[model samples]
Target: MKISAGMIVWSFCLAMAAGFTRSKPDIGVPVALAYFKTNAEVFASATGELQQSIDKLDDDPASVIKARLALKNTRLQYKKIAFFLEYFFKSAALIYNSAPKYEIEEPYMEYREPTGFQVIESLLYEAHPATKKLELLQQADVVTSSAKDLNALLYGFTANDKQLLESIQLELVRVITLSITGFDAPLLKTGIAESEMSLRALQTVLQPFREKATKTGVEVANYLSGGIAWLHQHPDFDSFDRLHFLTNYALPLQRSLQVFIKELQLQLNTTHVLNYEAGDLFNPAFLNLIAFLGADSSAQWQIGLGRRLFFDPGLSGNNKISCATCHQPEKHFTDGLTTSNAFDGHSHVPRNAPSLFYSAFQYRQFWDGKAESLQSQVKTVLFNVQEMNADSLALVKHLQQDTTYSKLMGAASPIDQIARCIAAYVRSLNPRSSRFDDYIQGKGPALSEDEIKGFNLFMGQAQCGTCHFAPLFNGLTPPLYDRTEFEVPGITRTDDLLHPVADTDMGRYPLFPMDYYKQAFKTPTVRNTAATAPYMHNGAFKTLEAVIEFYNQGGAAGLKLPIPNQTLSPLPLHLTPNEAASIVSFIHTLDDAEPTGLFIKKSNQ
Candidate 1:
């Protein structure tokens, strides 16, 4: 009755095979399986070999080179396996579980159908495999027993041949850790509806092909049916209300599939497929059905909306400044200024403009946690006199006149529609193709020694991950989508001209009225920290070293700012000047190239 990991995996595989029984399996599945099997076996063998090498090192320490090589190989193998596993889990779940079925078919129900396996597969192939590879690399560790072993490990890690492992490891861990909630019960539950919806959407897309694309489509449908059957049979199935279930699991799965399809297209160089017009994937009659099921929310729409709003000057006051002005796309969606210039231009905004890349996973919105939702944050920026300076009514009125806005907003109330569209877009801004991403995916040789050292320090002595957390690398408070908690870091008024204020800025408490939230700010993403300068509230520091030194000394030394309960612990990083520079270099590697012309395009009247 007790299922081992192997048994669990086997069962899942069988279920998958059974799901596709009516037709041939999609090529992606087999390719993924082959890759998974090969990597798993290689890793297992590599681990054994590494253990033997370690044993040999006991007798002859000079054999550290051999042990280091074995370790590196084992690490590389593990990276390959882990990346594929994540891909498989995401892809399979999309193909088999991302849909919704009403208990009773209602005449009034309007549903949006999901995207199909072909679409998902296409997207998956398009994704830069490097993104996943970099994530895996980030999670890897280089073991050393003594000075001799340390030297050997460093030598091997820095070797030209081993560059792949180093780079892949750095990027892999960064992406993977931020991609999913690791074994967190509540977070998992929260993700369920989205996942299920994604699966269901994929099913809808595949439904038409079931009779035509016999092999791939039928196979996908079968797996989906099995997953649905399993869900119905589960004892805890009825615990959640329908809405909760759909939002948490079903939708997320659909989203994942959409994302996967984009990845596939990227990998296969099938950009044409992605550019296919709406209603082309399914029959004309089914188009309405798809819309009713909410299945037409393609990755393009999601990602484009985020990018659009991100660059819209209308979102801010004066029609001159926009999110992009502060969070420059070329600089990895960070302004590269220490602190951002507010919309008014005369006053400086407290805190540096955090990178918008991979911000969806963050728990809170601002440094002081002023806004509760991403939507709220957007709204705040629109209305804040010093920031955007736009009245919500005026902004809504302006958007209501736009034809494209009409399409994106659909039938919802204007404000709600706009917010959701923008949020949908923001959520799609996850970064994937950094040097670190490549390393995580398996092509290795992406990062340098200094970068690797910084990564280790971040996870180890620096304790940066404790606050930044995984995957998204932002403050992710529990209870999915409950808005993030804020912290007051007691930033000082340094000699920096940007934030020359002598007093502290009261952060969240002013907005929320909670005693504990006084001066509390949201944790920003570190995905492109190197490009976002003037760190912290008031943007006092100009460089990464200055920020590191501030953290090492712990809080503005002589500042009269009140220390909040959640302030970071003093970390005398004890990093030498070179080590500090290495950490900075590593942070710079987090940048992803700016999104191209589409993001930069002005709105068509």
Candidate 2:
């Protein structure tokens, strides 16, 4: 039964008057087992239904529809245990929730085609697999068998109070970041229903942790209950004010849960993608540290050494080029050119420099999503002949020659340390408090009415939020900033949006050769869009308005580019000129009033 808002408040107050306590009930291993068992049962049932439907499909068109519809029920059942499964049984969870695309298998996993609820959904609904319907049923059988295997594997599943608390909070963040945002059920629009089911699961796991109805328990109970109730009330997909949802309900829910856990002195047992013990999703420290995952150190002194190397021309062969030659800080780290200058200076470099601010927020670096880490990105630029034209050995020798460099940079493998340090310096460049951030944080006057309306549109009909997600407004999806996302937003090589030709650059295809990744590039942060110009991989769009219009017209696909599987949904946004301007206004809010760095001139660097 759903707890009443008034009853929760009353309970909280009465319990508060009575005071709080930290003692726990016996940890519920059985609850975890039951959770796993229920998922196995549900997946098996769904698989059976699908098999039966597939059998009837030879004669009845309705059977295909029935099979398609049946998957939703199965999905909801899995959703109830989605976080629980993904938290522990991540490899097993992939059989249900993997993306409907080809993927290179991870080291431990076998190479296989995409097979999941989404793949099944697409086959039945979108792909219209006429001759392959039987093959689809075979996949269903495999999924069912895997679920049974997973059930057996989970026999030893256990959780202490700390893991339980961590899971719930992490799951709560997932609800706001992924669930309510429609990230999970992108095809079926079952995200809201799934979230409700997840909430029910949350209520179940958390029921045992009432701390004997003390104030701490009441607070946790009230917030979780209230969040669930709010979701129940706002069931519709289209009209849900997600911005309001995040600020009013979700933020409060996160805070209260933290307080509940802290008050109970729940010791953290493990760290997640945020890599911190607490894994506090909304904390600034968590936000800042996303980029600097593995290094010998991220000391300010190292960062200072990096800054020095950044401007020092000795890193280049002719003692003329430095990183700052192209990545000028005042210009948001871009050189304000269509493309950057080559080492020879007569010709332009291949691609425009992406802004350094918030660049490290995601694991994948570079416009093409080539480099896996920031240090590797530095290495790419250093040796790329077209860029800095410096060698690791030569740079280290140069570093040894400078007394100041030796003093600042540790007397070790100087070039490698310098590269890591430079990456650290780049990591230090963070987003300044923008108007949009301020408005979301409750300083309402930070954004004008038009900008506010624009934000709503961005999160709503414009489909910006669907791709460029919140907080960092990049592809590192919320709760865990681990996997970076890539998109093929069919764009032309030239600035002429009307006479479109597919941008010849095969973006992520070089790394992961697949049809979907053919023209797909990394989703870069749109934070300083107002400042950084000549957008796209080829630097085609010179103005933010032009970029907005490109998206408004559904990218190059809308411009009649023959892109079959262009990842950007090729549907015209139908934004009015005023509406487009409003979106631009909202984008402007992402710009720092001044770039947050020690500004240096390109000539000096």
Candidate 3:
């Protein structure tokens, strides 16, 4: 009558499948708390079994397979409560499952080694798991501790209907952006199954609310059912139709959930970067653009002043250069240079002047991410010796002399105010009027067959969507859009893939002073990429084709460059020329129509 670990897990699954064998109908916060507690126990149990298997590595040769199975089951259990755990207790979630890379906390300079399930997963899937036995055991212990800690935290955990619904929505986004991309499960490629489990958990969480809101509930349930079925049908990682999965299942589910929440009369109390009122993910209004700026009516008034200053050459040390000189409005806010002209007009700036469109959406500004905000970025540019090199106090005095400027300023305008105003104008640049935007919003003509294929390849095989993400097509991660990501792609000094030498520019490394951050640059948006040529932080590639080829060659590492800390995968993507061209065509679809000076017009009024 002794029960094996497999039997225990099977029994737990059976209990979960039977709705935890509760005689009463599942509904409300009490049911949710109960489900959470029970699931936590199962997770803890699975982790314990995994630890036991790891401990038995030397005694039993089959323990490696057993440990792997146990780890998978443990992760599956974690998925059941991932919505609650990840949303409510993000710090604890990190302990349970953080990225397998070493992280360094900025400013504080505290270096943290990788830990949790991803660490253990990498070890278990390795060719020499036995050689890493000690490390595996240590990670297993960490997972066990984390699982128990999660259980401890769940003791008094309580969530209202709105919170639960919001968590579910965020979970859906995570599935789309992170889970199915094999981000967390890079070695195992178990994300597809994990995503299905995540959806099932969401369904269970919504079961109580569904009874309260019938019509919207039915729509939500159907979408969930269809999405889950689709995931179950297509479990393969690389070949999965991500674009179809996103458009047909995930996007619709998000829309339905919004309606379902409204029908239940529950409004989110949290302040998120995303505009909850936006009905579609790719809708232009999907993100709250002003949320980042902390803008007000007065700030809106400053945009006109900002636009004037932006076009004024007097702000610079010399009387001849303006922001518009480099960020020409007609050229999609890029000067069509490999790097912009310096203050001397003879020399070039160190990096390319990226397109201003959608720049406001990013969490960080600048290629090296040295500037924390748009205002900060503007201030740096105004003072950089190689760039504007303007004395702030003098610039302020010079601007105040103009009667029109004095009228706009309302008596006094500080240097900080000037930077703020310019930042406001820059923030107003996002028009989201691309053909891709129109297509995603369902208000424009269908994309070409090549464009669709390119999009699929981008999202699926090319692994572009894994970093750029959708809607914004930037490295600002979705669900929480709080953190912008920087990666060391190991960009080469030249476009020569065969004799690639790593770019000499030390990118974020100089600021952070970490080997890991060497050549780490912000992942800029591909929104108007076709318009803004000569890409990468250092403008190493002169054309979009070269940029695509660089990626296709799997960055510098694939070209046999010694970029030990490169974040991009070294293995080649094996994309055909037609495939690469198609991706480029899809990128062209992201080009916004000419800016009509939307903010300038409003400011003039």
Candidate 4:
């Protein structure tokens, strides 16, 4: 029988259907295991095709197109298995499709260069693909080798039913935050199709559990089918109604999956950043703060104690400045200055004082992301000669002199106690009581038409959601929020849009000493931008309008500034003035509603 191409495609689809529809299992493990085995083989086969296509690349223009097509197919095949592969083999998965940028690991501080599909995608889509042939061949080799090693790792792997469900839930989060946002497929813009493929694979693995789930099972199936169909109908990248998709399909799907899991009596492991108990994505409790910062039973007491320390000027060398000096509560933890005043009171700090609200959510701290944790950030600010300029011994003794702090200090080291207490106060700042949060949770007034439009623009056309992910709207990437991302937006020295000159702040480069890290600063949360003014690391843009205009013109690159490594796309957003104002209005909706006791004023000394 001579196998025709159409027959080969049909056979492949048939085999996949058989794998999914085979005798329904009692539990999810067997189904997951079978799906993994089958998809792993498919991924390996697609990888082989990619390798062959890459080998055939030459002066022939058709060869390049064939290679690109092969690469895209291989990516789609890999998407079919991304859920399990990412959940089980996270480290290896990093090599497969992490961002095509140099990553610096914290603490140990190891620099890992980019590899895999994204790098290949960038190479293939570049203006001159022929020039990148050598590098493309190398990246292809890395991907193929990594895929084979992963297959080896999956040979006899076993996972519990609860873990499989948990992985599925996380995959939904990934699809919402990463896949639909074109995060991994920057050049290809194939995130929507990839999301559909991922959902199809998820549906296959979920069949056994879905069947057992009864009524809840029906809800889950409808959401899966509906979401897939929605993606199919709206294939255009720029005009895709992300807001509608998220509210109607993605959010409902997530809720239904939880219901299905509960109905099946499956327990989820709560060690991840995503809180399994949260009902919706924008719930105040959406992220597991406890997972981000280890559980503190005494957080309430620590927060109160920390508030006093935060307001005490004795913590500084001159006994005149406190944490509140730079981070004023009334101003939303920012001083409303272009840059904060230094210890000398005559000079200014190099960077703006970013709001402490939602500060505890990210893995890295500071503009350069040099501090590894909130505690480290507290310590660094306290001891820095240019900032607080605190004398460690004197500060400790000063705190120990206070009866209240002395009691809290007890047997703990004074410095450690101070750091912990102040850090605790900062951690307690995130209230997540914004109007947007309320609307997302189905409680607040419906967002205005303009506000809704602005949000859709932010998520899709504006491309803000790609970096400032939803829920937290911070650089902490979702699914597994282990790493914080930094980007170089090529900010200018001042708010002058017409005569823009690239700022001389080397940003993360001074710490990492890498070219790519140049001008790369940690992406901060825009949740309270309405309160925190003078945006960016240097606070060059005074008004929110100026900042929006700067971005509208595509950062410094759009301003014709020299920024070879600007990570922000240089393409103009072309936002009308009205559209810009609408976005600003939408951002205002993110201001936290008055919490009962968010701010604690200075004590009478």
The global C-alpha lDDT for each of the candidates, from Candidate 1 onward, is: 0.46, 0.72, 0.80, 0.82
Per model, how many backbone clashes are there?
A: 113, 0, 0, 0
Q: How would you encode candidate 3's per-residue C-alpha lDDT over 193-287 as one tens digit per residue?
A: 89999999888877888776587788889889999999999988776776678778888888888877777677583755787678657767777
Mind giving the per-residue lDDT tens digits that candidate 4 earns over 518-560?
9999999999998889899999988989988888898898788
In TM-score terms, candidate 2 sits at 0.83
**Candidate RMSDs in order:** 19.9, 8.9, 9.8, 9.4
Look at candidate 2 and give me any clashing residue pairs: none
Rate residue 164 of model 1 by lDDT. Answer: 20
Give the C-alpha miss distance for residue 454 in model 3, angstroms: 2.1
Off by over 4 Å in 3: 1-26, 48-73, 104-112, 123-130, 293-300, 392-394, 408-412, 598-605
TM match of model 4 to true structure: 0.87
TM-scores of the models, in the order given = 0.48, 0.83, 0.87, 0.87
lDDT of 2 at 275: 33
Can you write out model 1's per-residue Cα lDDT over 1-605, one digit (the tens) per residue? Answer: 88799998888789888863354334333333444454456555665665565455432435545644554454334434433333323332222222211111111223323322212222222224223322222212111111112112223221121222222222222222221221111112222232233234334333433445444344445555544443444323113222222223333333333333333332221121121222111111211211211123445665566567667777554668776677665666667776778776777876677766656544346666545456777667767777778766767766777666666545556665556566666655664556654553334464666677666555334445545654345665321212343555556667442343433666766765655455556777677677667677667677778777666555542233345343443324456677667667767766654554523534541
The whole-model C-alpha lDDT of candidate 4 against the native structure comes to: 0.82
Q: Cα lDDT for residue 231, model 1?
A: 40
Error of 1 at 116 (Å): 50
